[model samples]
Target chain A: MTIHHHPGKERIDAVRAFNRFYTRQIGLLEEGLLKSDFSLTEARVLYELAHRDGLTATDLGRDLGLDAGYLSRLLKKFEERDLVERATIEADARRSSIALTKAGRQAFAPLNQGSHEQVATLLERLSAAEQDRLVRAMQTVQRLLGGSAEPKIPYMLRSLQVGDIGWIIHRQGLLYAQEYGWDETYEALVAEILGAFVKSFDPKWEHSWIAEREGEVVGSVFVVHQSDAVAKLRLLYVEPSARGLGIGRRLVEECIGFARTKGYRTLTLWTNDVLTSARRIYEAAGFKLTDEERHHSFGKDLVGQNWNLEL
Target chain B: MTIHHHPGKERIDAVRAFNRFYTRQIGLLEEGLLKSDFSLTEARVLYELAHRDGLTATDLGRDLGLDAGYLSRLLKKFEERDLVERATIEADARRSSIALTKAGRQAFAPLNQGSHEQVATLLERLSAAEQDRLVRAMQTVQRLLGGSAEPKIPYMLRSLQVGDIGWIIHRQGLLYAQEYGWDETYEALVAEILGAFVKSFDPKWEHSWIAEREGEVVGSVFVVHQSDAVAKLRLLYVEPSARGLGIGRRLVEECIGFARTKGYRTLTLWTNDVLTSARRIYEAAGFKLTDEERHHSFGKDLVGQNWNLEL
Candidate 1:
């Protein structure tokens, strides 16, 4: 519990351990990367030059977070090796643009190819699905640590697969418990609903969607057959880590589309008013509050509300 | 196909992108980490000193992969700041042991605590399950890239959970296809087996154990009722990344233990000769090959073998 409010030493060590592990994994611990003659920093500098158009020493230092003196020294080494060429900028007399020379590109190509091969070798051991999982996990860590901005990776939706139900049950149970002090019953309710849905799954009338970003499941929603004319929207939830990406709204929209495609006259859902974020999403999806009742569930006194959207 | 033979530019770019993403995530691009006055390198040096005892300047330079001149200058700065005290070694006049002073520890404590809190905040958004997934994913990347040796992390076995079935099927299907050129029919067979197991799971007679290292599922085995007196071991596998970790051996042992505890007279399994790694583990665990049949399946000629262990 002490680790709850504050991270325990164990968690900190885990991060540090990962850092050490990755350093070795990437061969940063070695004198040179991928058995190349250039040091890790040198390879990084070479990479920047090989990829970017033209950069001044200041730009390189700033972008790479390198000290001015150290960067200058490294650049000098590259220059002496004929791996880089510096030309004075026409518009800026004080600045010179740095670029990879033919020799530089030649030196860099093998290193780049080696890195690619190394990563590919790592990935080849895994199945395609696991490769995706690995990439997504890396992206998750990057996103969580506030690093994913260059491409701003988008989320994708796919039909629910075999394991999603169990994950949903487990996540919903723990999430509700952590956020609202809900008990095990909420998780049991989820399992029961999902179990029945799977047991009596009608491909013609029922469908589910799971939202993923960088290969991580961020949200989910389900539509189940209720009657010939109506469909029930159930178990709509988005992960807190992926909350503001509009995944909740998107999930609702998908539900609505599927319900309409299946010729349902109305889509209805039951939820607690305590879930304000979900409420906002529901309300925005044009679901009207049709009923409200006081209920004690999940060990909390709550107002249960039913909403409906006419197709 | 070109990517398989030789990694494409995209794969190389993915690694570079991840590197960029991670650099930003860890605040290595910042002038000072966590808004502190220490550069990333300086903080790393401080961390090393605080964690270890009597490390000489040479040790720090070698371990950190820092240039001798750079390290000396940095140490000089620390000495001027009253942050580090160095003493000449008793036996060697040329070697000086570096130790952090009280002021250095004071400066480092907040930085260390800051890093811990940052990682904590990132993990807090995830449910425990998701957190475990993230950690495990990281460990997988590290292990695949040849890290994870400091503590030699061990694997553990746990009861099967909801999402595990899907993962097992997905991994098995893809792994077989990749490694043995087996087709989707193999995947379908795994799915059928897993589906039937879940649909008619008997807690008293059937049990599955998932092997996890750093929260990543590395291997699995199931002991299911072949008869009242016999238990069938199904879907025994260890990920290629997790091979040589003895997880396969452990999983087989776990099955043996469970079958004995359940009062089954024998534990048996059907496997292919192509699975030489698994065959070794079974043999090591005292399993005797009792049957073999040459079969044409999964797009290749193969020999199937059945092995059993007496309780």
Candidate 2:
């Protein structure tokens, strides 16, 4: 007897077909992309230099998500081509900043334009509503796929930056409205969260980032000053779509790094029992639950809790 | 001022992060999987060989989703390693069958086992319920990502193969139940479809295949007898997750191929107007909408349509 095959075979088959199509669609053809004048790796380095005016080798490696050794070789190729110039930063000799030469920018311009046109052409096929649906679908996919706890620091943390907050509020409001018929409370809570951050915003003492994937924001976090003795971790939120990818943990870690530089003695956050994942991240980052209270604020009873960690 | 960014930045960031994590999780380590005793290309050839024992080089290229030229090089490497042995079929000397050598099988066994273990381990981390959820989430992702139209020749049409039929019924039933609240009707329809196929199955005149991906069955289709002068296309269903990848078109094409080989002068299919996408595929494959009738059999308004194509 056949048991319930929840996802079923047809879907799996469709996925296989899609995997083939997408790989064909977006995966660059090495021969086409790599001209006689430039190797694939060399062209990538040039592209990097063209986009980022000044970056250290380490920074390049981080931004491009390339292995240091692989990036080092690619850099060497660019150096030989006279397309890239590397210089040590005067303040930190260990950091070597790379910039594109005149020729490098010239070579990069056409290639970049071609890529831009390709993307435009693909988007052109879709209507505005279809594009929106596609983008939303991609957002859902990214969240589902990216939310898992995967190692690799920069991209993981970057996935939780500022714009993600807007998406979180938008998605939460929509989902809550649909699922629980609680639009007013959901919107009110989101407004409160947004207001709290805007009121506390101080460029000198706080910074925010919204993480995006496939053109949709999925997560966000902020670092804000508390008393002179502490820095508060604020507005850390990751959408349910991006829940499993350890995006929450990475966001918390960013707050910790910012707090250390800001010279705070401790970091603190407010949450609730329902936010178990967020609480887990705080605890993993050496925070402990310090305060609790019963509350009813979004038309539902909730246990409000605070967590704190010494820097 | 930033307008709502097209392709939300947060989603892309999350996707990039997940790509990094998933690549790692799946053991896509360049050093290990790419640099084993077999070259990357050779390993790919071996994998193709293990999965399809008698595919020609061109067929192998199609199935492995590799470029013909790249696949040629890989085939050469596999030959050098004595992992693949190629021989011309007596029936068609121009075509060659590729079979794995003893060494190839030996090497493939460990690789396949390791790959299975990796996927199993990831699945093990979730509860059975969570595993089901993950699979459903994956289906959603595959549907969103894979739904695109691309063209290719249709080959063997396999209909209602065991696994494929099972998935089709399971998924169709669930979708009908969830979306239309017609569980009993859906169940009844699926049973009728299955029962018809089983009673009429004839391998000598018909063919079927269960499409498998990532070690799971995903789809199925079949072509069967009509009159002595015509063939009927039956059991053409794709899982919701696999829609948009042109599987339906492929399935239809397979039917055409079988009908041609069996000397049928025409092919026909029956479907509902609600399935516009499937109708589009039929029309694209040179089938013409011939008749339509309105009916309410399953407690809902339905338009029954018949499409036909002359060989």
- Highest-lDDT candidate: 1
For A114-160, candidate 1 gives per-residue lDDT tens digits of 77666676566554544555566676665545533423557899986
| Residue B297 local lDDT, model 1 | 78
| Fnat per candidate | 0.12, 0.02
A1-311 in candidate 2: lDDT tens per residue?
11122343444444333333334333433335545466655655666677676688887676455689988887787778777788878999787889988877877888765544444444445444344545555544344334444323323334222223334444555545554454235443553444355444566677776666444455778777778778777667665545666677877887888888887888888876876667888888999889999987656777889888888
Candidate 1, residues B167-224: lDDT per residue as tens digits?
A: 6766776688788987645655665566567656799999889988666677888878
Give the Å shift of residue A291 in candidate 1: 9.2
Residue A58 error for model 2, in Å? 2.7
Over the true interface residues, superposed, what is the Cα RMSD of model 2?
17.5
Model 1 quality (TM-score)? 0.66
lDDT of each candidate versus the true structure:
0.77, 0.60
In terms of docking quality, how is candidate 2 classified?
Answer: incorrect
RMSD of each: 7.4, 18.6
Q: Give DockQ for candidates 1 onward, in order.
A: 0.17, 0.02
